[model samples]
Target: MVAPPKPIPAPPPVKRAAALVAILGGALLLLWPAVLNGYPVIFSDTGAFISQTVVPLMIWDKPWIYGPFAWVFHQHVSLWFTIIAHALIVSHMVWLLGRVVGWGSPRRHVALCLALAALTALPWSVSIVMPDVLTPVAILGTALLAWGWPALSRAERAWLLVLTPIAVASHLSNLPVIFAVLVLALLLRAGWGVVMRAAVPLVGAIALLLVTNVVGHGRLSISPYGSTFLLARMIADGPAQRTIAALCPERGWYLCAFVGRLPDDADEFLWNQTSAMNRRPDGTAIFLGGREIAPEAREIVMETLRREPGTVVMLGLGNFLTQMTRSGLGDTTRRRDVGYGVIPHLRNGFPAAEEARFQSALQQRDELNAWALAVARVFPLVLILAAPFALLGWARAHAARDARALGLLLALLVGMTGNALAVGALSGPHPRYQARIAWFLPLAAVVFWRPRPGVIPAAAVPDPARSHTSPG
Candidate 1:
């Protein structure tokens, strides 16, 4: 007798579509400057790149002297690379996320919800030129590699192992996220063996960096160690000086006058004074001196706290409260100065006067203070509403056999909370510092999000009786 026709295995879900959405979204954002005028809004590391690296690369052929990557020195070339890289990274993240949540199955609704949560709520995260842009991509990628280790072909796993370090190097914020991932990996039954496998690439990268520094600079330091030397001076100055310099423009002017008169680089002198007081004295200043200030400040604040611990506690509480309420959208405070750098190159493409006008607008606070307050007040409520769904998603992922899902959830929780507390405590609870953790919050939300009632699980068996009979 002829055997009954066998059932065909279903195709792996079309996770690539989600990636396309991210790519298209990122592409649209790159074109935003045409319409938006002051597209990036703030003058920060992004502007630093545009001026110091990108502009120079376009004009001169000499080896670019900024950041670890020399390739980013040219403006046009860097812009093209940025757009393409952003698209690829964003798309890859979306695609991986779709696969994680089973996008093509009944759980597709959940997947879509997760994607929307990531994209819309944290608008700055999706478009901005900060290190946080890479956070989601790195965290998600790490989580996937950790989760699918067994199921992945040997080649795929090896490729992932190689990519993890490169992902970590993409941004400093990623280091904490990576650490969290490593912790979760350990917790998920990936012992030292798996860790050693992952470490090979990271170690190699470190060695390469060291070799490059020694060969290029005749020293073992990376990136000139400029910030590190400045930080040493800041730590010696004392907190009061640092605080005054940071808060009081008059004090900054005084510092500039004092340092400017000295027979040294005015910038270096000012940086030295700031670092000696505000930062730690450690030879290596990690996180750009953020890690040192909190504990030191806490010790200094201890006497005040001892006298009024309740009041101090209340202030700490207020910090968290204030952070929850703030509006994270738009860069209103920092001015974007174009002519301050290479104005000649862009003179043909953009009018100098018009660029100045754009710079002026960037410096202004576009949103009213009252508007920011109102937004801040309602922000926590939105988070509260989203929390339950997110928790459900986390629970579902937690129940999976793969450790990476659990690791992702854990990393999301720890990184978001840790960064929040660290920034809140150290930086005296500024909304902008809290904004650094903004991308993480939404990621955590998506990882833990649950579908509304009626949505089915992705991999359900057809027959209830047969499913009941199957081994656990």
Candidate 2:
């Protein structure tokens, strides 16, 4: 008898088509919140990104990469294009992650996406025009490159190698988050080859940010205003205020004039016009009074850290804890006031028609508040209750010798904690900061889930007898 043709490694054409359909459905689901809102969500920073495309203006607070990223998608067209691009990116990352673990089937991938959309802040993150969506994208990308590299196809590896750096570069906090994840992965012995492979993007992201800063701001630093943000956080947390008071009469810092009157909130201290670091009397726009105060800000931050190490440590710990539990979607959906900084920028950069659409959007009308707030309140409790069961599933996956799956879970856990620390302790605790990456926890829970003996269809499991086999 003639030898049978060797079995094909790729999925059959019909199965591939089904997988494509499932992926498309997941992308649409991720876009559903914006669809419901009748327009893409816009944050105060959205305008700043838009303004970059209009002019070479460098806002002291954020990197310039996101401005070009937004321009590439929207290109002065409807902002919906930008949001859709984000949804597609996240959807594809999820599909790739599933393939690396045991949940490679289209059905499982879609189900997990649906659960993430419904139960977490992922949908809101994607729906918005902010760079927040990239937080999870970077995490997922890091996981795939670091632990799932062995199982990934050549094309998948290449795609992530290029995309992960862009995702990581889009935001300032992402660099530290990726660094923490990779360090932990190395400590856990995830494999030097793959972990170092992941580090390519992390290092590339840092290089990219620094190069851009050099070209844009004429500086070789990752963030020229990083000290200002830290100073704001310190001032808000109380340590900086005490330090300022003690050093003021001797040092004669500009802020010495407002000792007892410092705003307790970071935003108030930074944005409130009447407070310190006020905008010019001409009403010119600037980020917390721009880079002029960076030297002073750095001095305050260093002095505070030197004087009140214990108090700073305790406050940072408290903020991190608060951020860890503060995963809610409300901030992304909140109403955008007409007078908000984002509004004027939007009008200046976008066409009149696009601006009109934004003015009439449900978010501008504050119509999304009720439902968004309700979802924000209810889903966090669900996440807390599900944490134990998710841990159990992760332990089971580890027991089954699914190293890639287990490694991903550990990496993501570290990433989430790192994000909390970076934003909460270094900046200030905010729901949106934690909300952006919170969905990954639920995604990890799904990755750890194994099929019940008879509950899953035979077609869903590629091989029933070897369901627990490690993908790597």
Candidate 3:
């Protein structure tokens, strides 16, 4: 959806017989590492997802859906199911984007989809076991639905409608990212109908996440560390210290004692595992302790902002800019291990002896790592540089009009910025957080690209909501 699916006319795009082969080739490439491993690749967080799934104990950091989904596979000893399912889901979304713009002959569409796979680290997110991949899914789904809904076929519309919410529901961070996208749409002048349709799933996802958390945790909670993470971000940004200094011995913030000991980076404070937050021996954060500290975290953020408003604003803007260019492949995990991350924590029924047997079967991803590293590093920066031009191009393409192309570009811009704020501004600003949504910049560029020499108005000008149909 980042690309406004414009029409492709001349130079026959797809050859009938070659289409399927091209698509299959891309799918294989997307899942190449998973295939080599003999099982799905695992991340440090993958264990949390597996634990919550099998134990039925709600882990605040993990969403309710992922755990159950992971559990079913773990129970059946079909962990590869996670990687394959993620692959097919993302593959279809990539395919749908190709169809939306009405690209080329059959061969071109296939080639375009394959080309997209190569040009971005989008697929690598799916190849690993983490929720970051879904951020793109929600972004693309909402963009396509809003921009090309009129031209989309019923199946295409339904595909996006179905997948969008699931993607949103997959991770807590996605909620704010998608919400920012919707708000940006309105700011950019997208119609009320467009916003409402997009909101349906966005709203549904929020509700689902809550209910799922209630079911999993037996009590209602949105992510367990919202305020704490925010507090961490404020601290990292260098303002929470003001609040901490003022509230020390008199307040029971627990954190007050270690005020000077805080790390310069938020990730060091929140994720170092040995941070004061991790009181338990089992590697789990002390839940009750976190609860006691959580309320103060919110207060610290607000009070600090009051004490130093300009600093907070500057930090936020810096984070947003940093987010625009920090994407990189394999940023989420250490990027090794077949299923060992999941093995040690397998609810006692599984034995530690089996860990060695499941270690990644084949260990060479030299080619993938090399290519993705470049895509991750260069693509986001290029997109950011090209964003203003892309937006201006969209506007210039019109005669006192702005439509889907601009909407798609704006959505990508806002979504990436918002995600950076949600995930990075608070707690920490990691390249991985930005990487999740960074690659979409290039896709949007391609989707709403400038037309050839004298192509008059660009394809499919903006339209009213009622008049739209998913492209056939």
Instruction: Point to the candidate with the largest lDDT.
Output: 2
Sorted on lDDT, best first, the list reads 2, 3, 1
Off by over 4 Å in 2: 1-12, 279-288, 337-339, 451-472
Going through the candidates in the order shown, the clash numbers are: 17, 0, 19
lDDT of 3 by residue, 259-374 (tens): 77676677566666577555543555765454556777777878898898898888887887676556665444334523344665653434453344345333323233444445
Q: What is the per-residue lDDT of model 1 for residues 271-355, given as tens digits with 9 covering 90 to 100? A: 3434432333343333433223334433333434444456545554565566545525434333332224333433433345534
2 or 3, which is superior by TM-score?
2
Q: In terms of lDDT, which candidate is stronger, 1 or 2?
A: 2
Report the C-alpha lDDT of model 2 over 170-273, residue by residue, as the tens digit: 99989889999888777878666767876987998999999989998899999887888888888888989999998887897878877887878998877677
Per-residue lDDT value at 244 in model 2: 91
Q: Which TM-score value belongs to model 2?
A: 0.89
- Model 3 C-alpha lDDT versus the unseen true structure: 0.62
- For each candidate in turn, the TM-score is 0.57, 0.89, 0.78
